[model samples]
Target: MTGRRALRAVQAASGLGGLVALGAASQVWLRVAVPRDRPLPDAALALSGRTVAPLVTALAVAGLAGLVGLFATRGWGRVVLGGLLAIIGAALIAAAVPHAWAPGPAAVDDLLTRPLAGRDPTRAAVATTVPGWPLLAAGGGAVLVAAGLATVARGRRWPGMSSRFEVAGQRAGPPRAAPDGPPADAAVWDALDRGDDPTL
Candidate 1:
């Protein structure tokens, strides 16, 4: 109804959408890039096992919190939701930057047929100097950050429609005095017969 209410609605929708996108991306990355069969670099494996999974779980929780906050009209709830979104975005960026900027051994060696008999090469030696994965991850992270920011902004003016309704009621005021005649409505006519000016 009012601008604030409309904004809250928009923010809620954006936050939910962003959260869903982030979750989907994380799941896809894990399935394709961190599959069980693949021998992840030590660092990559460690991060995926110790850092990324927890972060994803946290982000999902935050998304749910944001949705609840939107409905509850609680200020602190919205803030927490926004903060969660930020955390998720930051985690994505952190994970993506290394992958994008520094090519790992997996980037160069053919995973399908690479021999395991020889000494494993360092990520620096086998890393590809491309900006593909990083750019995609960064872009997605930026969207999430933006979504979080939007949620916080919208929270500032939430429940605006309630205020509008109150103001409208106030403006309508008490009924005006009717002209010296029975009012048109049958209800008013009954009041008039009872020596009461229903308009007043």
Candidate 2:
């Protein structure tokens, strides 16, 4: 594809990936239930991806912000940002992969136990892996990696912010006259006052 089209595609993919990760992080990755005696209600704990892997959420947000930076930057600046995005993507993948595969009891307990310490001194919460959200988060990370790689490879040629504003600013400045003549005033009244023919 052409540079501009490729840039647009990469940006769109990056945005999609960021949104997917954010959505996944916000959703429940695990459901924990504490088994109790007949008198107590089983405490239902919904552990979101953010709680399990905070890095995923943080990196996803960085990726989204980098997407905006891509439009504003070009050349080496864009390459640097792309590299940062790639790092963020890789971190997200690392954070989500383990949880996606097998969120073991210990891992779950270590994260959930502290909060339940005061509520239930003897917490035997069984955590069921939701799996879907983590998988989606990993998928998003993969997409972000692809986008970052593409940007680093080809973003130097992609169009930067429009130069129309710069051109407009130049145009708005005081008009210059031809080197061969005095500055020509376009006002008819000025020509008449100068005892010159307005028609000419």
Candidate 3:
């Protein structure tokens, strides 16, 4: 593909990746069972990806907002933003991969303990990971990294916003004479006055 098309693709991919990460963050990543004393049933709780890794959501938001930066900036400015986007993607991957493999105690402690504050503190809760969501989040991060890398490598050659406006002006050719009341000579004079090539 041309550099312009490639840059557009990168923009699309980056936006999609951010959306995927946001969706993944809202999904359930873990299920924990809160045990109580005898004769009481264990309380089951669901922990979302946001609870497991807050950084995932934060990074996703930043990545989405960076799309505008990619479009508005150019040259070294774009390169710097691309590098920053890559770093955000890498951080998201690091934050989510661990939860995809296994649940960490520190990961669940904060959100899990909030609801069980008044209950039995000695009871052990079994935390089961639903890896689907975390895996999805990691995949999103991978996409963001790819988009950012592509931007850093080839963004300088892509057409800028001014180029698009110039292209539009060229495609417009010359203005046409009004069909109604202005005589042909009058129209020619108007074109000449405006420095437009009337013959064309």
Candidate 4:
């Protein structure tokens, strides 16, 4: 692949990976903190689950779009990526605010105890005893938001092989040889030129 295409691939992969990580974290939080076994108050559970599912799905879809977009070099791909990042960032901020302002001790206790049902609660209890848990939670959320923002920024610069080819073609450089010897496989070169994997 050309340098630009490589860069775009890296950006897409990183964004996708970050989004997946964020989604997984959110899933873990939901599974742990939210009462799963007991039926939730209809409105609370439905609203909560609804809010989270979309954000996670959006992020995952955005990542996938980014990957496809990189290859297709379509404006729509960037739009999808940008939109997903924006939604994910907004969700993180919205979720974090409540956690940030929550009663520190109670919130911490709930988070800690909710996860472990029958395990030794002493160590967990001690850990939750610390102050500033809300702040910590908010900070963690902010970090995820920042990561989402970074992914969005990277998406905006989606690179492609065509641009690289134009630049390289313009530069004054030494004549290059056909790697496979004289009368090279023009088809292979053409495929590579268009950002296809020659090995495939």
TM-scores of all models? 0.43, 0.77, 0.77, 0.34
Question: Per-residue lDDT tens digits of candidate 4, residues 1-200?
Answer: 55466455555543555454344434323322232232322111112222323343444444444445445543446545555545654554454344323234354454442243344333222211112332333343344344345445554554544544455557556855544643348867886886644554
Which residue pairs collide, candidate 3? none
Tens-digit lDDT track of model 2 for 1-200? 88889889989999999999999999988788765555667878888888888998998998899889888999999988888888888889888888765466577668864554334446566778888898899888888898888888888989888655345345455654434545356665786675544554
lDDT of 3 by residue, 1-200 (tens): 99778878989988988889989999998898777765677788888888878899999998898788888888888888888888888888898888876555555565575665345558667789889888889888888898888888987777667643443347555746546654599777997786665565
Off by over 4 Å in 1: 1-69, 104-130, 160-200
CA lDDT, candidate 4, residue 141: 38
What's the CA error at residue 18 for candidate 3, in Å? 0.8
Each prediction's RMSD over C-alphas, in Å, is: 10.5, 7.2, 6.3, 11.9
Off by over 4 Å in 4: 1-73, 101-158, 161-200
Model 2, poorest ten-residue lDDT window?
175-184
Candidates 1 and 3: which is better by TM-score? 3
Ten residues in sequence with the least summed lDDT for candidate 3: 163-172
- Each prediction's Cα lDDT score? 0.50, 0.80, 0.81, 0.43
lDDT at residue 193 of model 2 (Cα atoms): 78
Instruction: Determine which window of 10 residues in candidate 4 has minimal summed lDDT.
Output: 41-50
